[model samples]
Target: MKLHGYFRSSAAYRVRIALNLKGVPYEHATVHLLKGEHRTEAWRARHPQGRVPALETDEGAFLIQSPAILEWIEERWPRPPLLPEDALERARVRAVCAIVACDIHPLNNLATLGWLKERLGADQAAVDAWYAHWITEGFAAIERLLAPGPYAFGETPGMADLHIVPQVFNARRFSVPLEAFPRIRAVDEACAAHPAFAAAAPENQPDAA
Candidate 1:
């Protein structure tokens, strides 16, 4: 498998965590988003959306969308399962993942930030304020939804936890305060202690350059 990703992309970070947790061996193909490589025709051929973190399988399958790619990884390698077997448990986990993936992430993605700058004439401070506001609102809800444990759902880390870890990492990069969300902070801390999360961190990537 080959993963085309940018080191700082939160979506790419999520997929990296999922792959590492599943113990999958994949070659890295760094697509520097800052250099506009993701927008190039060569990269666009793999994912028309021109997004980072597209996975190309040995069977010649290419996957776009971080959520879909993660689900595929979960299905292919189920040992340290990310989703629970029970339907209700899975729903709960999905809800948590959605809070970050759909609600928070989309609003603060690089494209959106660029739009705010170019279209709205927003400065860096304004863009950062926009980012923090959404993250604060989203994380407050996530804190309420979390069970008082190491992970989001329960005692063990699961799909929701994987998504949460990267979202929090992004939040920190933007200087968002974690003080108001104790449960979310705890979950992120717990995840950071795990090898899977540690190994998948952006700073640990060989091509973080």
Candidate 2:
């Protein structure tokens, strides 16, 4: 498998962690998003939305979207399952993943931020504020949603931890104060110590700037 991704892309980062946790070996193809590589015709052909983290499977299947790719990875390689065995626990984990991937991440992604600045005439300060506000609100809910853990669920890192860690990385990148979310912070710190999470970190990516 080959993953097309940018170093700092949170969506890409999630997929990377999932692959690593599953003990799947894959190659990395860096798409320089900053250089508008994702917008080019060549890239669009590979990914209709021209997004980072498009996975080309060994059988010649192309998978797009971070969440979809994650689910695929879980189903294909189920040994170190990313979801809980209990139905309710699985739902809870999915909810937490949705909170980060659907609610928080979309609002603060590169496209949305660029739109706020370029299309809406918002200045840097305003854009930064918009970024931080969504993160704070989303994180508050996630803090309450998380169970007691060294990981997000219980003893092992699951979907929630995979999603949250990347968002926490983004939160800190934007200088969003995280003192209010102790549970979230603890999960982030815990995941940092895991080899899977640490290896997939943005700084550890080959394309990291």
Residue 60 alpha-carbon offset, candidate 1, angstroms: 1.2
Q: lDDT scores for all predictions?
A: 0.89, 0.94
Residue 118 accuracy (lDDT) in model 2 = 90
Alpha-carbon deviation at 132 in model 1, angstroms: 0.4
The sequence of per-residue lDDT tens digits that candidate 2 reaches over residues 71-148 is 999999998999999999899999999999999999998899999999999999999999999999999999999999
lDDT of 1 by residue, 137-160 (tens): 989888888876888888888888
The runs of at least 3 residues in candidate 1 whose Cα sits more than 4 Å from the true structure, single-residue gaps closed, are none
**Where does model 2 exceed 4 Å of error?**
none
* Worst ten in a row by lDDT for model 1: 147-156
Evaluated against the true structure, the overall lDDT of model 1 is: 0.89
lDDT measured at residue 179 in model 2 versus the true structure, 0 to 100 = 99
